[model samples]
Target chain A: MEHLDALENQSIYILREAYKKFKKLAMLWSIGKDSTVLLWLARKAFFGHCPIPLVHIDTSYKIPAMIAFRDQLAREWSLRLIVGQNTAALADGMGPERGRLTCCTALKTEGLQLLMAERGFTGLILGIRRDEEGTRAKERYFSPRDKHFEWNYKDQPPELWDQFKTDFDADTHIRIHPLLHWTEIDVWEYIRREAIPIIDLYFAKDGERYRSLGCWPCTGRVKSNAATVEEIIAELRATNTSERAGRAQDHEDTYAMQKLRAKGYM
Target chain B: MATDIATPRASSNIVIVGHVDHGKSTLVGRLFYDTDSLPEGRYAAVARVCEETGKPFEFAFLLDALEEERDQGITIDTARARFHTARRDYVLIDAPGHKEFLKNMVSGAAAADAALLLIDAAEGVQEQSRRHGYLLHLLGIRQVVVVINKMDLVGYRQRAFADVRRAYLDFLAALGVHPQAVVPVSAREGDNIAAASARMPWYDGPTVVEALDAFAARPSREHLPLRFPVQDVYKFDHRRIIAGRVEAGAIAEGDTILFTPSGHRGVVKSIERWHPSRTGPARAGESIGITLTEQLFIERGEVISHLADAPRAGAELRANLFWLGDRHLAPGRPYVLKLATQEVPCAAAGVSGVINTATLEHVAAHEVAKNEVATVTLALKTPVAYDCFTDIVETGRFVLVDGYDVAGGGIVLPPVEDDYTI
Candidate 1:
């Protein structure tokens, strides 16, 4: 019953700890409810100020509303927003028209990979949760991404207590998942409780809402009248639907997500 | 045995462990099937495969059915499945009990909230049953509920059940994990799985589902010194944000906080939870950010604390080691030491000794064998903040990496009291 308070408190503590630990760090903002809430946590963590760079890897194929909303929040919060993109791939005509996995990699993962290299960013904060995927369920709060940006999902370290394996060799950036311990329902509940600002995509527009956010070409809309955050939480409670139901690459194969992760796809 | 009670559904991880061919997967599969948590149409495909392969259609068929597993009728890796009781949702980790997959077993057990120790009544206790219990104990899994499985074979005999219970308790006691409850069931024949069995009328206890519902949750301590591992630092405009999860205790406005390893110091300018619209006091478990008074050497992996109370300071820590890697761990071998988010090059210097997990006795040995538990003093190339895994399991525990792989994991056992631990 008190797990919500415990979950929140733990997240806040992690935010503060990351602030105190890594000097050169940035956070990955996907503009979804989870990361957006992570943004909200950042504001709370820094006392109404986001001090780290909010890096959003722009595939340039995202929903226009997402772009608009991102800019709106960036301006309002005065965030040091950094837009990352794989410009070359786009120029080459790579699109979801090719393949879901190929599109995601060239855009989200590859774009972020290029941004990370160009900026020399060593630590990237993510809002991924364990319950989101089976492979994700095995990740540590402080997981390491290799120099090649690979996630050796099979062999993860033992994260006993709160001690995470944060130290890695040079060129190896760490991926901090503060939301790894949270669930999908917990995210919406927190959104409702916190009243965090979200894009209109989540709310039903013509009886369809984006249950999960991704690239516009790939992300599918689910039928719902859950116009409010509270309603979304209620819908999730009564169903056993997977949170990433709208995500494309996860369903291409049984372990497509794992394969993508191993290849450095976030 | 079934209650429609929902406690807002926090996730609970349950690791299913038992000897090979003891129906660990079948038990998990049955639970998934009965709870309606399966992918809806996968059962028929599993049944078709069984028919095509001439293998019997059973609950154990729920795994991905790897070729090796199909050939041997055994689980290979730690396959996982999710189910929900009325009380809460359960992420079940199905671990192979065979010695070959011991590494896989430990990986699964590491993330579990509790364990379901499945012992076949027909076979009684086996090598893996004892080994897993020992491993679970070494890994600090305090809650265990023993399932006396294959009860239909013995017709759910009370005496047979009691005999196995007593023997396993002795083995478990040697590993320092005592079973909280012993429930008899048959993974096959649908006996005492989702529903209670009619065969065991004399025995009165909560069924497996009920026992899970009754299993005591790990209590959070808000009184401990504030220990937060810095996960990330966000800098927007002119303000810097420090983010992490609260491992223990609580924080508020004006609290003086310190960062270790980096050794940065600052006061909490404001207390904010994850709520964006309205800022207020924050508690444990929430992954929110924090603002400090002065910009310090803050980054990912270092533990932040209130300046009033500093954690037990040490670059060199004595830890309880459990080797799960393919390579044997030796002293003077440089490998990666991971604590919190901070990873540093560390040497397993002065292998002060190894612990005999079977007897829970200290065997003054330097050479640590694979899959064996040991006690050793570790020296880090760079000093990092850490507490004994006992005082702060969240911050005290760490894993060792050889090259790019996680080689071993150990808990900073409270400084060996009298060097006698089981």
Candidate 2:
């Protein structure tokens, strides 16, 4: 777990930096393994207590178990959990049938945008890793989003050494990514080492398991018998299957994630 | 079961830098292809795109993922790829070599443990070849393998390779850098890449992959003096924990630590890790918390180190830096200087000279423009603990923020003193 140790240190450093730099900050927790591990790191960073609020954009299509797990941990850890949803869009019949990208933009990106506007939060901590997707690789640790929450990835600020772009204009918000350097295997390895509690949806139930969690309607499962964390790690090491192979949204188009992210989808 | 006990493979961050269109991306893509590191269907997917578009298969296509970059056929940002050799794993950072993308290059080079300075043998040494070499020196990347690429364009001639190598070596020598080796490669032809080139029988050296595998990893600085820059102080229900990463050396329970700038001292009562399984001494690169015996008036942006070998605290110091902002860096204008966790209002008291990165010539200047390196004397509003860039990279470097942007970055000059009169 030496590699995990290094990754943990770097992540904790970034988390602390975010906490110290931004006054009104919140962490996005998808109730998935990566965000759960990020939550654990926040607790470790703030000495067993995370003062930052955890924001969850509930799409109303999430698997039932994800909500259950989220609430259980929030209650157990006494976390300041904040759930945001695009109620108007959901009521207007916004779903995957109306096009995956449109549905995601309304439910996820617009939902988070409304949440930010209402709460006036300047910084958002996310559990995104570069190895997960092509667009994610181009992201800086502290990425800026304009007033409309549009990501200008083309003309990004210069980020050299450990000097991140923490300072932003009044209307600009920064997305803090602590797990950008870690890989899928690194996450699983750290989860095992720290004994972090994760939702069982990742474990194989009936010859299949969710490699990447999302809305129940769109998320698919990969064939695997990796029932334990250690088994999952071994499978990840040997398998060439993409981590998001089971996430249907990513496979919707070649640049689906990029298009979603450009509009500020976490 | 034995795999559980086996140590993790040592990993190094390697950056590839060269002039624009020098095949930096192609070289990186070739490495991934030669090592079979591309994920399932990734290569095939890109190849399929090429076929559908009626374009020839390009290794660079694998990395230029962005729409604009693909259309322009230029890398605008640093692309990272993980490649594993029999000896170790590498995080290969492919830096854009365009002059305007110098910031991206710096961002990539800053995290590198070693570097591959690529130069086209046909073009000989270009402006970026020298600029990148100068940057690698500034970033403290001592281990470098100069890659003279495009041997095919130069007919794989030993004389062409030697000419570029000799010129680049001279350039590096002027910057006080001694690279580990100079390698010949043709990323397009796959010569001296994964395997030695039969075309260049006269040249005998390690291939690009072999050179990378042979590059030495940075030694752990655990024996050095402890430098724990306080990131924050947390009070979780009366159990106050001072949180920070151990940048250098180690810290143990009962160790007397001193906070710089504030000049507060206390004893470490205990080391706290979130996982109950972790206990005992904390070594370098560990981000842990510690409960102090006494609640001293300590805050973030202070360096906590052993009292015996404490870091120098000063208000005025000399530094070497490179400016990347659109506006020129001039004296008398106060900017935020952030070093480690500390941020203070600072201004350039004096600009001794600005060195043209390409030519390595010192020129008298009142302001440092974009892509220019300079030595300046900074006047800080508050004293901060720091070391020379050569002594300790963690505490030695800083960024100058102007109006909510990082305008410039630099390293502290050695022999910290209070008497920095302009």
Worst 10 residues of 1 chain A by lDDT: A154-163
Considering the two chains of model 2, state its CAPRI-style docking category.
Answer: medium
The TM-scores that each candidate's chain B achieves against the reference are: 0.90, 0.96
lDDT digits (tens) for residues A132-181 of candidate 1: 76566556677788888997654555454454555578978888888877
Q: What is the lDDT of residue B334 in candidate 1?
A: 82
Report the Cα lDDT for residue A5, model 2: 76
Q: How far is candidate 2 from the true structure (C-alpha RMSD, Å)?
A: 2.3
Tens digits of per-residue lDDT for model 2, A204-224: 988999999999989999999
Q: How accurate locally, in lDDT, is each candidate?
A: 0.76, 0.88
Best-matching candidate per TM-score: 2
- Predicted complexes: DockQ each: 0.23, 0.60
True contacts kept of each: 0.26, 0.58
